[model samples]
Target: MKSFDVAIIGSGPAGASAAFELSKSGISTVIIEKETLPRYKTCGGGFVFRGRKNMPFDIASVVEKEFHSIDTYFSKKHPHLTTTRDQPIITMVMRDAFDNLIVEKAKENGVTLLQNHKVENITFGDTQILHTTEGDIEAKFIIAADGALSPIAKIAGWKETRTIIPALEYEIEVPKADFERLSQNVRFDIDAIPYGYGWCFPKKNHLSVGVGVFTKTNKKINLKEHYATYLQTLGITEILSEAAHGFVIPVTPRTDIFVQKNVFLTGDAAGLADPLVAEGISNAILSGVQAAQAIIESNLDSEKAAALYTAKLEETILPEIRIGAKLSYHFYHQSTFRNIVLKKYGQFVAEAMTDLFMGERTYPADYKASVTRKIKEAIF
Candidate 1:
């Protein structure tokens, strides 16, 4: 059995960020990954400024593309709104490269990394013991940075409520001549794709386009059929290489109790994903950093660590998730309301959500004080 101060399961942005912070704090941290470095994660590969702000190191060298313009389209209203900012508000990068870069940085900072090790079972008592395929390992504390369907969370008997948003993403190779048109805007459309929206994010030589919808009342709409139909309508038939993938995005927030004795949970494992846009990259990274800080600040006190971690989340991320959940409900439930708002202040809406993603603004309170106030005033 091996011993460490912290053992992190999963090597996504959340796990990597936690390990990085732990390494900087001079804690004996180890990151165990079930897959090899640069392993492919099924993601849209979009990075909002929220995660970028929390990064302690420079990521300029690894940034694939920095976007300043966000184009939003409401299919029902037939309105298109474009929001532009002075600086890079959102970024696009390959998840494999981006996640690997952070983990590699953590490794450089003296964090031990174990690859191809899958954590099978975790027991929490005097000291948390992790049973992995590699072997048994003990740690003073455990951070379940594992993903939405985290096995560790299940083993620890953590209750996570999930509202799965089904998404189908495809990376298609586009020709050089057509690259400019596709790369110009990161497009998001509502109404045209029922229950959810279609997004086109530009990559180096390919385009990542996908449609996602809430899975509350399971509809038999075929994602691939819609994706194909949309692409054909857009006249993007050029094909070089393609990879089709599907994944679930959790819209629910964390349960009331996120900490159990010596174990901590964050990221999708704890259901910290935003409800509106289904964005989790930044949320996951932020959760990981907060979880690590809570652990260190508690002085190895599990109760304090859990409380602080939950507090930080409520203070920072929960508000956004709450607003997002409300927005998600509105967007899916009431198309008339969605179209009215989009037609009125589509650009403002995009920028405000972008602001949250960029860490410039937070949730619920901000919404109550701003839009809700404006809406109330306008109504009266």
Candidate 2:
């Protein structure tokens, strides 16, 4: 049995980030990846400024493009909103390179990388044993940093309580002329889909276009049909090549425990994707760091690690997600009332959101109350 102080499942941003932090502290950290490094990960590839700003090291090498501003479109009800900043608001990256960079950085700090090891099951005890395709790994702590549909979480006996929503993304190569025009800005088209939106994130060689609806319903939603409509809305005429990928976003955190039997859950496994924008990378990195810190701070005590990790999340990530969820509900579901507010303060709202993405501002605790106050003030 291969033994380590801590073992992290999945080498996504969350897992790589945890390894990076743990290795810095000289913890015997090992990252178990089902595939080799630099493997493709399905994401829109928009790395927001907030995530970039908190990065322990520079990632300029993997950045494809950086936009100083973002454009948001709400057809007919309001004018388009463009928000700019002195710094890049969103940075584009191909996930394979981006995720590999972080893993490489972690390795530099002495973390072990167990490639091609798919975790099949885990045996819980004083030292948890991870049963993988390659071999069994024994570790004092386990961090489940896997994606939304975490096999690790399922094997760990977690029941599904997260509000998951479906998303479709396409890597499309369009005509040079169209790419030039669309690549000029990062854009979001609100109401392009029912109860959700469409986004266009341009990369170095292609465009990552997708449409996702936030609210879940019994009525069937055809996201492929919406993607076609969104392409027309974006003035995309011809697609020279295209690759389609479908995934789910867990917008709400699990209502159950985050830590059980010395195992800690982070990232999409814990359902920490931003409710408003469905941005997972930043929070994934954040939660992974927190989980590592908890183990380090607890001096490898399992009970203390769990408590500390929970405390850190409640203090930082969870509250923000809770508020963002509320805002998303109003922004997407209550279109009539939301449109009225947007018509009046559309630019202001967009700027605030841009600032949030840029790490210039945070979601206020009394967000709903503040918005209500603003609506009343405007009406009165």
Candidate 3:
């Protein structure tokens, strides 16, 4: 058995960030991960500049593409609108590479990583103990940075509600000419299939074309077929490859009670992904930082420290996600109304949408306020 001041389950961004913060405070911290480092992870891999503003270390080395404009389409609706931004709005990278970069940083900061450790069970005595494949380890505090199906949060009996959204993605090697054209812009098609969106995100040598549908029943829409249709719509007929994968993602707003007793939860395990865009990398890292701060600020009362962390999230992040959920609902259902707004508002609408997408603004409260104000002014 090995003992540490803090133990983190899951070596994603949340866990790595928490470990980096804790280890820098001279606290003995250990990270347990079920999979080997640099595991294959499917994601949009789009990180906005706003999300990277406060990172603990430099991230330029891992960025695959930095996009300056966003083109949103409404294919399911009658009218379509495209929005563009003159400035860079999103930084795209591979999830495996980005996560590995952070974990390596945590290691460099003196955090011990227990690779290939699957947590069997976690129990809390005077101190917290984690039973894993390797052995048992004790810690004064534990953070569950695991993911949506966090074993640590479940072991602590922390209640959480997760709403699943089916997402299918692909890493396609497009023709050189197609790649050259896509490199200048990032394209998105709303309701491209149904109840979801399709995207063409450009990288160094390839384009990520994918779709996410909000269907409860697994009717099983052929993602590859849908991708082909989308490419045809874009006037693309080149078939380079058909490599693809599908996964489920939770979309509801996450809670602040992620921290409980001797345990705390972060990232997907804590259900922190934004319901609107399903973007979570930045949120994961932010939550990890807050978790570490809570531990370092913990004196005689750990509850107070946890409460502080929850407060910061509620005050800063939760409100935005809540609004994102509402806006996402409208975007999925009210395509006509969205098209009207986009065509009418054009750039203003585009910039605002970009702001919300980039985490620079929250659509939940501000969006409602805008609607109410418009109604009062009889604009609608």
Candidate 4:
């Protein structure tokens, strides 16, 4: 068996981030990916500024477009609201290029990457043994960044407690006229779907349009039909072949545990997507870096590493997600609540969100107390 200090499953943002951080620390690490390098990934491809600011290196080479403002609407005909920032609030990139860039950076930092190698089974003993289609390997520690339906997490018995939500995306090649009109700004229509939202993100030559839903809700809605309606609303009549893809987004962290012995679950595997925006890239990178940090801090001690990771999650990511979950529950569940907030304080709320995404402010830390107070005042 080929042995290494750390082995990461998946080569997405979370896995690549962990590999980069581990390689920088001189740890022997390898990434095993199920797909070939630069393979297509289904996502809106909107990289929020907060995530960009947290990246260790510049991503200008991969950024397709940067937007300074966002246009939000309750519906197609509703009076839209705009939020602006002096700096770009969001940078868009195709996931194939963006993910590959991160992985290449990790390789530059001396991390080994095994592409098109699917891990079939994993055994836990003194060290974790990963049996892959290519071969077998042993690792002192495992970081599962394999995403929403992480097989590694399931084998390690960590996935059952997580909350997974359904999401669908389309890479639409609209007419130049439609593209120009739609690409004027990043758009989000909240009332396009119940318990979720629809977004139009402009890339270099195309638009990434999609709708997602929080499956935990009891509402039965056809997401595909809704996506079609969304495109029609944007006046996009043609969609390229193989442009539609469906995936799941993890909305809440695993409540039971984030770490099990030598295995650490990061990113969507750990259910780290933001509840409010359904954004996962930022939290994925953060958790990946934190996981690497925990291992480094513990000197490869499994128990200590797991404990440290859990503590770091509590200190940083979990609190915000918890508050976000509460906020989403209230905002999506009650139309009356939404109306009250939008009618009375929509502009302030939109500006606060823009500031949060721009890294100038943080949720729960900067607005939780005030938001709670305002909501109470509005309701009462």
Highest-lDDT candidate? 2
Q: Relative to the unseen true structure, what is the C-alpha lDDT of residue 319 in candidate 1, on a scale of 0 to 100?
A: 73
Clashing pairs in 1: none
Checking candidate 3 for backbone clashes, the offending pairs are: 147-268, 147-269, 148-268, 323-364
Least well predicted 10-residue stretch by lDDT in candidate 1: 371-380
After superposition, candidate 1 runs with Cα above 4 Å error: 364-380
Give the per-residue lDDT digits (tens) of candidate 1, residues 1-380: 88999999988989999999888888899998998988889898888877777678888777878888888777633657777777677788888899999999999999999998998887778888888899998998888888878888889886656776788999888777667777987877765467887888888778888888853546667888888876764568886788999988888876567778677787888777778788888888988999999988988787888889989987888877777787678668777655555556666777777787667776655554565655554455
The TM-score of predicted model 3 comes to: 0.90
The lDDT ranking, best first, is 2, 4, 1, 3
- lDDT of prediction 4: 0.87
Order of models, best TM-score first: 2, 4, 1, 3
Number of colliding residue pairs in model 1? 0
In candidate 4, what are the lDDT values of residues 1-380, reduced to their tens digit?
A: 78899999999999999999999889999999999999998888888998998899999999999999899988533478999888889999888999999999999989999988899998898988999999999998999999989999889876487667887888878777888999989999886878888999998998888999863686777999999888877788866543888998888888898888588999999999988888889999999999999999999888889999999999988998988877777677776767776767888888988987887776765455676677787888
- Candidate 2 lDDT, 1-380, residue by residue in tens: 88999999989899999999999898899999999888999998888899999999999999999999899998855779999898999999999999999999999999999999999989998999999999899999999998999998888889999999999999999999999999999999999998889999999999999999876556678999999999999999899999999999999899878999887999999999899989999999999999999999999988899999999999999989888888888888888877778778888889899988988788888887888876876677
Model 3: per-residue Cα lDDT over 2-83, one tens digit each = 9988888988788988988887888889998888989978788888766776786888888998887777766543354454
At residue 60, what lDDT does model 3 achieve? 84
Per-candidate clashes come to: 0, 0, 4, 0
C-alpha local distance difference test of each model? 0.81, 0.92, 0.77, 0.87
- lDDT, residue 118, candidate 4: 96
Best-fitting candidate, scored by TM-score: 2
